[model samples]
Target: MLSDQIKTKCTLPHSLYRAQQIKDFEGEAAALAGITLYSLMERAGQACYDVFNTHFPDARQVLILSGKGNNGGDGYIFAALAKNAGLSVQLCQMGVPDDLSGDALLACSAWQAKQGVVEGIEQADFEKADIIVDALLGTGLSGALRPEYQRLIYKITASGKPVLSVDLPSGLNADTGAVSDVAVKADATITFVGLKQGLFTGRAIDHCGQIYFSGLGITKQFDSLCSSSVTRISYQDLSDRLTPRSRTSHKGFFGKTLILGGNLGMPGAVRLAGEAALRTGSGLVKVLTRQENQLAVIAGRPELMVADFDLNKIDDSAIRDWATNLVIGPGLGKDNWAKMLLDFVLASDLPTVVDADGLNLLVDKPAWKDTWILTPHPGEAAHLLGCSISKVEDNRFSAVRNLQHSFGGVVILKGAGTLICDGKQTYLANVGNPGMASGGMGDVLSGIIGGLLAQDLNLQQAATLAVCIHGQAADLAAQQDERGLLASDLFPYIRKLVNP
Candidate 1:
């Protein structure tokens, strides 16, 4: 009921611009907004100042690590504002102050006018500051950090003080979310002009702890000029679609999710998937497994229809008619029995969400189908695309897009920030945590997608909504105990989110 009171704004429709795109519109956006470049810089600095004060109310000395770029200009402006606010401020320059120019030059002058002295990194003290702001690099950063910058950043990170970064974290590739050598780990980041697509995916998650965004008064201009290639999903975007069902609604109103897995020794895998399907609002869930593991899969879950009887005798068409959608993978092995089951499913028109070992089999003889969702981790995706895991890791955006085009279905590249692509549109889920690193997570994700598919959601909606729900459920479970989090722990949260 508390969720009902929370206002839902224009949430998930917000576009995420690439680093280049954000830079492309900065000057024009400022001009169109009836503001100057320095004025926007001042506003960016002011926004950061207000947020910094709120977050670090007891902060004594605000230490800002400034570089020679426009990002440093923001730092200088922030330092000036901090001084005016009667807060202690310390400004450290990465290079000689003589090198600063343009808006940055004006910002530095404004800071000096406030009697704030700038010191070089060699003379600055790290221990005296409560919160450190990293303004060393912005979107222009491409290659790895220089040796000097790495040492200082390492020192700042190892200091354990809460760090705030301006724009993108220093040394992080703002476009691809790739990090070379080292990047600053900030407790919170204040971004100006636009939200870069890189900050929400890949290795960027580790560096960007909490993000604080400000359009710097160019909201109208920025929104009009940019259209994101990808979108970010949150609960607000989908809450209306997943509202409580009518009082008269029955279980049969939802679709049946038929799960085919649990091949010989791996009985627990299929059980996890089946239970997740039920938890996520599937009307009925049936598991087709080997006779040896049928009892083990249904030991504690009596709701599931676990069947392996007469599978050798019955035809493939009989199984297809029993369910609305299919989740084929979680323990689907490469053995003959597994292959036979795969071929049988292939003969049907059932919409399917594939994962785990089933993904392995599909890679060998790839085919196209619009009614399928492929969930592949970096390793599995590498095998399917015949490329190295590092290549997939290097540029996840391109990899996911390639996978969708090659596989002809909605593809979910699972990782830190899961990427969901359907060849035309792409979406990103930023709700998961590192605790979801445990096993059975992917299996659970496949089941959730299958459950949504059973509810008659289209390929894109099922993939997008399911991925966000799965990740957010993990986050909720992880809050209690992230380190010891289990895939099954998400059951309660999944049930709650689906009902919200």
Candidate 2:
């Protein structure tokens, strides 16, 4: 039976490294768990063979593309196994076999004694194979794709055969998930040792068509290493955080949430936010919208207490008396009236969850920065930080950290792997999917965080729970229909997850 630690270690949270790193990390741990690293490698090769056979059992004529690393060593081992299994195996070297050293060379010698070998890859040979094992240029790649490897990648991409990449799809940045000019587009990528974060996001999603992970039976060793606090939250886990209610519980137990947004023509922003706050279990929800939106606020959702007029209509004294914890900047336009209201809300003593246009206005004023959670997408974060989108993408860890330092509060940088950085610590949420790249997603997330805040969670706790639950809900919804999953798809599920 696989232990939970081993099951978890099968998917690495970081990038790929030299097989030696895998060996060093897993060797001692596997021994303590009553296994060996070499034994793990053998199991890895066997897993690859099993996957290949299960997926393409009739592909008797096989082409094993080997590099000069242990990844290639894995390929050589599998090639020998395939040959023994009565398949016509051809060992094609992207680099010369003579250049292979260490375990890779040992595996190569074993293959040479059995299967036929070739020094160079041929286009005709590639066309003739029913299946191709892409072991070329595994994890140690950096900078750009090598020219020779680039050409091979292009050819393999054009081949249209079943290509199973060993470890990561070569030429892709393992840590950042960035792909250079060329990368092998594989049918299935069987990643061993650990699942690199790159495999699920950015260009990786396209290059790696199907992802399969194998622990190679050394999970306990890898888990022993210290890890970043970041994790992918699923619905099952999020639901566990919900405080089960007793029949004796009353509304007074939950705190009030004040939603301050909805400029002149955008009352719907606060409308949705207020409703979401109520839905998320805030005892009382209030909406401070433009006076013109008073009727709409009351008509759209009568359950909320709508504060009349813009923020300017009410003095700091009045604003202070109204809200407990505030949520600002959902559909807040950049008009002067909206700006003044935003300033008043920012200057207020209440803890705030800043989102949408509120963040835009805060970036402009540059004052009101302490214990406020600033939520922004890549473009918005770039604007606030005054950097290009590429710079932010190049290093998200730095970008999020910079935001928290400048703003003096928790920062939720929303994107593929949404980052919640609280100045000292950082958490990466890997729950969401591509289908969630639509409008109104941030709006919902802001409201969720606001509700948590109203429920008396600290700024950091509110942000963490809100972001995790949001992504977790999206992940759960995706299980039903990944292609059609939307931001609103998480609404009902979010309520269930938070209140379970």
Candidate 3:
């Protein structure tokens, strides 16, 4: 059974580190806290047991998989504790017990002294266990998993039983969040010391069901040893940026946003973007689209000013002059008309947001502009970088940085864990859910960023805050159900998020 805490969202720390960083400095941190390595291992084991007891107390049978490293040692200590608590515990060993050394050997001996039984992988009973504990590997693991380990991981996943992983799930890359081949699909993971950057992004979201963090009483000391590789931001961290508007302020005080898109057959994308812009507190929003899309763009949202864009009219000076910030390429098709409009938008000095077809169009004519923000999903990002989608998703941190370095602006790599990089620093927004797979979601995000940009927020601030707001809105809208969620469903929640 899943715990109530598992269903509820967990608050995460802002700073995130790579596995190597934590491993390199953990000993120093322990010394600073006046604790030995074995003591730290004991704390890690105790923390894992506490989480298991709190989250899965109803379970009477516990199966623990232990390896030969420190992670396995944590499991041994947990097994001893569970046995002492009068719970039925089965400790399965993946490697020879004599191979263990250091704190791990000590832990194994302690468990044996407690009259614990260790079984081989072949003797383990998956059906009899209420919950499985994964302690097969630690942060030091990289590259492909051993064939035996892979077999065990596959078997564990197939068991359909709840799993509690100590540190990160086995076979998961702690630095990049990339799985080489197979990884344990843990129901809940208790990460120790510092939070691993890999646990928040990429394939980690699918493999790690729920994440729980334990500093193990050395968080401050550990954090003081090294700087974080990335920073995590959410709605609560950025909501203060949207302060209450001055009572005397007029419509023009918030600035105007000009959105360009909505090709002949697709008007919904542009409409969603325009409405999202307005809902996000843009003082005014104007849409310049095809003549056929004019009515569709303004049908229900009469507040939006829609105009017919004359493709024959080469001069767009007047339209360009109207917007304080620009959002281009929601439903834009990659025809000559799109190219012309894109070129026109690029020629201007306006701070702009480029998304959807705009990103697709950029593949042909790549130009670096510091004033624009480029938002791209994996496919579009792979196109922009001339690489496979797998390559981009494999190491999203590297891809986002490369995109920002090449594009010379803020780059938002949209996915399960959205990454925003501005060349200087990178931020990860751990909000949003599977429901965001619906169409027009990207358009909504682009418009939200444009709206905030028009309201005088800098490029980084606008991108970060808009992303969190957009994701938080989606989460709220998906509260009742994530399936069948539409982009338009986020409007009311978006309004509330921005006001916060």
Candidate 4:
């Protein structure tokens, strides 16, 4: 119920930031709405206290690691509240309390007036504490940790205290989720006011364990104030976009989908895609593969029709006539046969999703066209966009936006936070888990999107729905256990979700 309520009321980080940006830009508009930045900060601190107490009810001794920023102010406020609530609290200041400015200084002054002791860098054993509140750094932190803060962070990590980070963890870059040097590892992180983008992607997710969000009394109207370039995919969202068909609907009502890949040794790629399309509600599914693997394409899934995609015999018109929506990639090799198949698909005007080897071939040839969805992992997306994989990793939002604008089609920049872009609009998918790091996952996703497209969903809708459902299935599969989970394991769950 908690997670469900979060999904329903709390939005993805990017959307939350967009809303806050708009509210901030309005200047006095927030005041008009009975909202103030200081009030937001107080609410943030209070929410952090609530989450900490809820997670560690038995923890009596609390240590608050505070910086000289508004985040520190939050910690100061929280420490005061904890003390008032009859919990023993300690403030280990990373810097001089006199160095604090703005609301943070005011908060410290308030706490000091209340007889709170502010101590300097001392090796007070945090292991003896019940919980540690990390308010040492805020989203404004960039680059490496300063020397004093570095020592404090290292000590906190080594202390083995159960940590509850206020907003983002100290030393972790909120925009990139990249750690400059070392970062505080928290058991739970409560983000407030606006959700930072970094907490959900890259290394941030691992560092920020058991994440929670509190809007801090910000109105929903603030959402319209800013525009976010990211979105998240959740299990609860799958059925809303992918409802079952009407009782009177027939196979003819859905469109035809074609899977164009599966080289000599990779018949499973096309097979997985074909089966996924069928399961995802595609009316008619066809596999256009090499003649050598014609029988292999329909191995277990005999319902799908197999076509021998021989270049010498097949023409563009013939391929066009079969697939209303095409998914090229999966096991597609970067050979001449694969090239011819890709050329045929690109020339046609049908909606298409290109992934895996299909992306590799397109990078080599470098053609620009629309009506396609390129689902590339970081490496593939990097190659296509002509940048280093690290650069893409550092800034996924920018990389995905570039891919969409340059390629002139919807782009599914697949990774932890899978980005979906269709020129003007961008959506971020926060579904799935680290368990989905296994092989053949991209193949399954490609097929799901192709199938959704065949069912007459528009390109944008199909991409979002398919990505959400695919990640959601993997998330569910991992519930049994994540370590040994396989890509094929998601099939039954996918069928249940789309058809149920």
> Residue by residue across 253-363, what tens digits does model 2's lDDT show?
787788877877787778877877877888888887777887898897799898765343567566567567888888788888778777677667777888888888866
List per-prediction Cα lDDT, in the order shown.
Answer: 0.84, 0.74, 0.90, 0.80
All-Cα superposition RMSD per candidate: 3.6, 3.6, 2.2, 2.7
- Model 4, range 1-500, lDDT digits (tens) per residue? 13222322245344534323533553343555687666766777778877776778888999888888888899999998899999998887766898899878888888999999898757455877888899988675766678877877888888888899988888887766777678889898887655677777766767888788865555454454555666555556656776656899988788789898999898888888889898888899999887777788777789999988768765757668867889999899988999998888767888998999999998878876778888999999889988899888877777888988888778988887777888877777777888888888899999999998888788888888888889889988999998888888999989888854
- For 1-500, candidate 3 gives per-residue lDDT tens digits of 32322212456678888888988999999999999999989888888888897778788899999988999999999998899989999999997789789999999999888777888877789999999999989685878999999999999999999999999999999988899989999988988888888998999998887788777778889888889758999889899999898889998999999999898898899899999999999999999889898888889688999987787774767887788999999989999889988998889889999999999999999999999999999999999999999999999999999999998889999998899999988899998999999999999999899899989999999999999999999999999799999999999999999887
Model 1 poorest ten-residue lDDT run: 1-10
Sort every candidate by lDDT, greatest first.
Answer: 3, 1, 4, 2
Give the alpha carbon lDDT tens digit for every residue of 1-500 in model 1: 11211111233235677888878888898888899998988887887787686667788788899999999999998898888878778899988789999999999998788678999998767888888988889786767778999999899988889988888789888777888788888877777677788888899988987677777778779888877788888765875667578899888999999998888898888899999899988999999988898889889588888888354654756677889999988888998788777777677778998888888998776878888899999999999999998888878899999999988879999998889899877888787888999989988998898888888888888888998899889989988978989999999999988987
User: Which model is ahead, 3 or 4, in terms of TM-score?
Assistant: 3
Clashing pairs in 3: none
Better of 1 and 3 by TM-score: 3
Question: Weakest 10 consecutive residues, lDDT, candidate 4?
Answer: 1-10
TM-score of decoy 3: 0.97
TM-score to true structure, per model = 0.92, 0.87, 0.97, 0.93
Candidate 4: residue 326 lDDT (0-100): 92
Q: Which numbered prediction scores highest in TM-score against the true structure?
A: 3
Q: Model 4: which residue pairs collide?
A: 22-225, 231-428, 232-430, 233-430
